[model samples]
Target: MDSWPHPQPLTNRLELVAVPRPVLTALVSGRAAAALPPPLVTPYLAGEECAGLWRMRSMQLSDKPGDAPWVTRFVVVPGVSGAVGAAGFHGAPDQVGMVEVGYRIAPEHRRNGYARQALEILLSVAGSSPDVRVVRASISPENHASRALIQQFAFAEVGEQWDDEDGLETLFEMVLRTQ
Candidate 1:
C-alpha cells in the first residue's frame, strides 16, 4: 500500500497509523462479546447481532479507497509497550472544510490518557491537512471524560446536535488557524 498522508505522531507513548485488518481482528478477538459496548457494535454489524467485537473492528478498518472525501481511520499503537489500544478518525472527508473526530478506547485500556493522546495527534494531523480549515468534536454532554478531553485540546462549545442515532451531542469546535 502507498504511504498514507498526514501520519501524525501521538505522545511519545503512542503512534498513529492507518487501521489495518489484522490489527482490528486482534482487537475484537481480545474482548468478550458481552463486554463490548453498544456504540462500538452497531456500526460494525450494520445493526445486526454479532458473536464478538470483530465486526465493529472490521467496519472501522475496512475503509474503502474512495468511500468519502473527508473520512479517515487510524490505529492507536502504543510505542513503548507496542500495544494496539484503539482506532478512530477525522470524520467525513466530504463534509467540505469541516473536520470532526470520533474514537473508542478498548475496555482494558481505559483511564490511561490514551484517548487524549490519540485525539490530540489526530487533531494535529487534521489541522495540518490543507483540506481542513476547522476541527470539531461531537461528544455526549454526559460523557465527562470526553468533554474534559476536548477541553484539554481547547475545543470551544459551538452548538448542540440531536440525531436519531447519536441522540443529543454537544458540538465542540476548534479552529486550526489558531493552533
Candidate 2:
C-alpha cells in the first residue's frame, strides 16, 4: 500500500493518531505493538469487537489504498497511554461526495466527551474538503448517546437502513454548503 503523510487532527484534549497500513496489518494479526512499523507506538489494542472493526478496516485499506489517511485512527489524550477510543469515516467520500463516519469510546472512557471531540474533528475534515459534500452517520436507534451527538452538529434525520451486522440504523446527514 502507498503511504501518506500522517494527519493528526487535534483538539484541546485529544489527537486522532493515524494508523498506517502496515501497523493495521499487524493489528489484525493480533501482534504486539513491537511488531508494528517503526516509529509508531499505539497504546491501544483492539478487543474482540474492535478487532472485527479493524479487520473490516484492513480490508478497506486493501481495496482503496489511497483512503488510508481517512480510515480508523486512535483517539488519544496527549502523553496518555492507551487510546480513549477509535474514530474515522467508513472510507473516502463516495462517488456522490458523501462520507459516513463511525466512532466508539472504550467503556471505561465513556461520558468523558471523547466521542464528541472525535466527531468534531471528523466533521471539520469533511467540511474542509472540497470533495466532500455530505457527511453521514448511521446510528443504531438504541444508541441514544450517538443519536444525541449528531444532533449537536445539525445533522437531520434523513432515513433508515438495515445493516447485516448492525441491524436497524437511523440515518442522519448534514449537507455542506459549497464555498
Candidate with best TM-score: 2
* lDDT agreement with native, every candidate: 0.56, 0.79
Runs of candidate 2 exceeding 4 Å displacement: 1-11, 33-44
TM-score of each: 0.63, 0.86
What's model 1's overall lDDT?
Answer: 0.56
Itemize residue pairs with steric clashes in candidate 2: none
What are the per-residue Cα lDDT tens digits for candidate 1 across 1-179? 11123334342446444534444454456543444333333333222222233453456436654423333344344332323343345444445577677766655567887777677667767766777767788888888888988888778998999966568999998776632
Q: What is the lDDT of residue 179 in candidate 1?
A: 25
Model 2 over residues 1-179: C-alpha lDDT tens digits? 32221234443657677876667787898884558643333444555767887889898877888888888887766565666778888999988999999898887778988888888888888888999999999999999999988998889999999999899999999999653
- Give me candidate 1's TM-score against the actual structure: 0.63
Clashing pairs in 1: 69-93, 70-92, 70-93, 70-94, 71-93
